[model samples]
Target: MMQPDTLTVFYDGGCPLCRREIATYRALKPQGVRWINVADARPAAGGGTGSACPLDRAALLARFHVQRPDGRMVSGARAFILLWHRVPRFRWLGRVAGTPPLPALLEGGYRLFLRLRPWIVRRAVRDKRAAPPG
Candidate 1:
């Protein structure tokens, strides 16, 4: 299997809300990351696709997940923190999140995000496929 340094962001490509954020991330940070859409995680692509392991689409869509080099899986706020820490400018947010209170705070915030996630998900599903980055 091919893996890159740092983090791999497995997101719901079908989610407009998610894709909008991904699009912003793509525009702002151009290094130190590989963004993988759950829809694109086909077995032929060497990424987890089917209901095996921790990479299936439905599972991934439920939350943000990051696969570390050591094969550890971090999800939700921790996953976002790992990812935010990698972005050039937003790395500080990750640092802050790693702090005791901040991660906890983010977790609380993540719960809220999930509470509102279904509404967000519906909006995202309504979004048209965006142009792939050049």
Candidate 2:
């Protein structure tokens, strides 16, 4: 469980794109945001590297997620909103995006991104393991 002031973010560390984005957020060093990479084996679900509300590994890897201080788990575009809400520069954007019907529109776009995420990850990483075996 998170402290009243903290928000826990769950991400896939193995993903190059995810790593880069998380690094960017880490650079900002926003207060009360705890980032966890779910790529670790046997991730804890009660806080720290593990999430307060754990999801299946596959599900965690498939989308972005965040657990609020109250232990509610949110994901995809909504998760991004919670994150942006913490960052000073992006706070307005988060609030605006979170407004009525905007989340729904963003979710539609997020679902489309999910469909192409494999391709995007492959292109971003360009690692041998991510490449097609021949």
Candidate 3:
């Protein structure tokens, strides 16, 4: 069960970029935040005992999602904004980006990124495979 103050983040762990970003956030140890990896068969926090994700697996995996403390589920750039506000290092960026026009512009950019993500991920994988062992 999630507390009313808990913010839940739904992320796709299968994507390398997403995984790396999520790992960075986890390292930050934000307060009152729960990270759920939608790519897992049974996703949850603390060894699969957290509350179930609000959306179905497909919907959760489609884009970035953040369930605010108030229980509002936000996606895309708006979702990123909500997440940024929770992290001390990103709060300023969130405030600036959440401003009018910026949010819209950021959303457009996010949409484009989504469209190119598959190719980007494939290229990243290919590059990793071709890199010689350190």
Candidate 4:
């Protein structure tokens, strides 16, 4: 059930890919969706509470996470499922993916991403550092 109240999502702000994806979602201004940076455990510049999800910073940063209305914390594909429900544009995805078989598939993919995340972050950082400042 999508709560009209708020969904606190914890993400890795330090990761370029994570930042870009979150920025896209933020641009939509999804209803009741609060973005938080795991790196600092602070609400995004947009809005929300500074301390919402009471979880270890390292665990939150290690994977995608979301704090449900009931205060239950979910991670990885499950977290994304919670997130999609909050965003109108992606609600369908949340429904379709929530069903059997789909969740397993999504979780598998998410796990793969987790394994590659470090390398991806490193490459992005290297590229950014190499770019000549304008």
The candidate scoring highest on TM-score is: 3
- Name the lDDT value of residue 51 in candidate 3: 52
Whole-model lDDT for model 3 versus the true structure?
Answer: 0.84
Q: Give lDDT tens digits, candidate 4, residues 6-30.
A: 7888898888899999988888778
Higher-ranked by lDDT: 1 or 2: 2
List candidate 4 segments past 4 Å from native: 1-4, 42-52, 128-134
In model 1, which regions exceed 4 Å deviation? 1-4, 43-53, 121-134
Q: State each model's CA lDDT, in order.
A: 0.75, 0.83, 0.84, 0.82
Candidate 3 displacement at residue 79 in angstroms = 0.5
Angstrom error of the Cα, residue 32, model 1: value is 2.8
The estimated TM-scores of all candidates read 0.75, 0.82, 0.88, 0.81
**Candidate 3 runs further than 4 Å off:** 41-52
**lDDT tens per residue, model 1, 1-134:** 54456566788887667888888878887466767888666653434564234655666878888877666778899988888877767788888879998888888899899889898776655553453546
Q: What lDDT does model 2 reach?
A: 0.83
Writing each residue's lDDT as its tens digit, candidate 2 over 14-82 gives 988788888888888878998778888475554334434557777788899988888888999999999
Taking the tens digit of each residue's C-alpha lDDT, what string does model 3 give over 29-80? 7777888887875745543324554677777788999988877789999998
The lowest-lDDT stretch of 10 consecutive residues in candidate 4 is: 41-50
Reference-based TM-score, model 4: 0.81
Better of 2 and 4 by TM-score: 2
